[model samples]
Target: MCLQSDLVDADVDPAVIEATRSALHQQLEDAELIHQPDEAHLQTAKERSEQLNFAISSLRRQLDAQTRDVVAPRFDAIADTSPRVASLKASIDAITQLRESWARVHTINADIRSLKSERRRINKDIKEKSEQLKARQSLLGDLSTEFGRLLTSWNLPWVDTAVIDRDTFLPAVNGQPFESLQASGGGITTSVNLACSLTLLKFGLDHADVLVPSLLVIDSPRKAFGNNDSDRQRASEIYSRFRTLADAYGERLQLIIADNDPPPVTSDSFGKVEFDYDNPMVPGVSHPGPDHVSRLEETADE
Candidate 1:
């Protein structure tokens, strides 16, 4: 019966099934069963059960083989023993480092670009400043030449050459700074100061845009000179120079000199304000005495 069931479940050909049924009938007489079924269906039912069990066992073996093939590598990776996975991790780390390096390189390039731009701007500024300095130096040179000429005209023959200091614009007399001759006392200092003032005046006259006023006030140019021939000569020379400058520039320049004694020149040629002992420049106002105040009051009453 089991054989017949096997044949039927296997879906064998009808000819094979008939052959199996005959074989099963012969074998069934020797077979055993716990619950004896009706003879006609017994073999078929047993065959069906056997075939189903064999098919399930075969499918279980195939499923186990497939699971081993697909899941063993994943288990090895979980165990941290897969070479392929380690190589992939290394590749990922290398790529990440390369990306970080690229970012740094990009930042460096941007900084270089910015610094280059700044350098160009700074260079341009430096060039402009240099040009301005050169122009100022040229102007100072011209002024120094004019100052030297004026100093020579004022009878300072020692001041043959004059140069302006680049930084201070102060005169250098005969290739020496003006301060070098400061030990020569007030005469030399006063004369140099006057020469510098006239130099500025000349520069202002030449350059219309210059803000220098056309007026100069000197207090006692001959104050340092004593009652000696050399001092008297120097005083005369200074006054003569002043008169010459006034004549050359005419009303365009104004020079006011205040001294205890006047220059040895005609007062008619130049304006003069004289102050003597009787008509003192500073005349103090006097208050009236008591008798004078009483006389004024009596006059007011009359």
Candidate 2:
């Protein structure tokens, strides 16, 4: 019992100890069984443990080799290339700045090309407009010459030569505007108006582009002139000039005159329409007495 108690204290079940002792005693009686391990089996176990240790050592060596293979080249590459990387970064930065500068240059070149094209267009337009102005000025020169010739032919009292101003396109007698003749008298004004009208009629007939009709209407050339011998003589000369102009233009021009009395001309070149007290130009109006009728018609008919 004390031994069993001791066995229990040693954490060995007494029943299991007894069973193991009985099995060992039975094994000791067998001829093939020994109390200690066999040398051959111990040697085999030692060989197996040595093989396992060798395999573990080989695996550790392989792991170290793999680590070196994976990590050493990366560390070497990092140590060798720091300067090259910095140089490549600087080159990249330089290329970036050059590209930015080139882009700016390209933009400026494009703007310059656009402005040059616009300048060419403006020059073309200016040339075309200038040509048009030149043509208009030439036409005006021709008209001025024609107008001056008619004024000279009419024998203006004070005017030696007449010309149309290029800038104003108005008649200038002796390098002065025709309006200056208005200060002289109504006789001069009437003469200038008649000459200008005849000149304009001639110009209209000659130029296809002129808008004026080839017709003239004069109310009274001698209305401003008083009843005197000098006025009558001037009126006769004006009528003679009219006859000459009418004969020159012939059927191309139509001249109509409405006057109180006819000029002292015996030429059969012009037709006359006489309106008397008995036969008036307008109806529903009493004519003046037969004594007041114009005797210029009798002279014209004769």
Q: In the order shown, what is each candidate's alpha-carbon RMSD? A: 15.9, 9.9
Write down the RMSD of candidate 1 (Cα, Å): 15.9
Candidate 2, 144-220: lDDT as tens digits:
78777766665546768777788887777786676686675687678777777777777787777777887889998
lDDT of 1 by residue, 1-302 (tens): 75554444556578877899999986776574533555547788789889999999999999989988788878877777667679999999999999999999999999999999999999999999999878767777888777777777655545567666777678777766767866666777787887788778868877786679999898988887577776777778777777877777788888888888978664333677777765655346554555666566878899
lDDT of each: 0.77, 0.79
TM-score of 1: 0.61
**Top candidate when judged by lDDT against the true structure:** 2
Per model, how many backbone clashes are there? 5, 0
Query: In model 1, which residue pairs have backbone atoms overlapping below 3 Å?
Result: 1-43, 2-43, 2-47, 5-44, 6-47
Off by more than 4 A, model 1: 1-35, 38-46, 57-89, 157-160, 174-176, 208-213, 226-237, 240-253, 264-270, 278-302
lDDT of model 2 at residue 119? 94
TM-scores of the candidates are 0.61, 0.57
lDDT of 2 at 191: 75
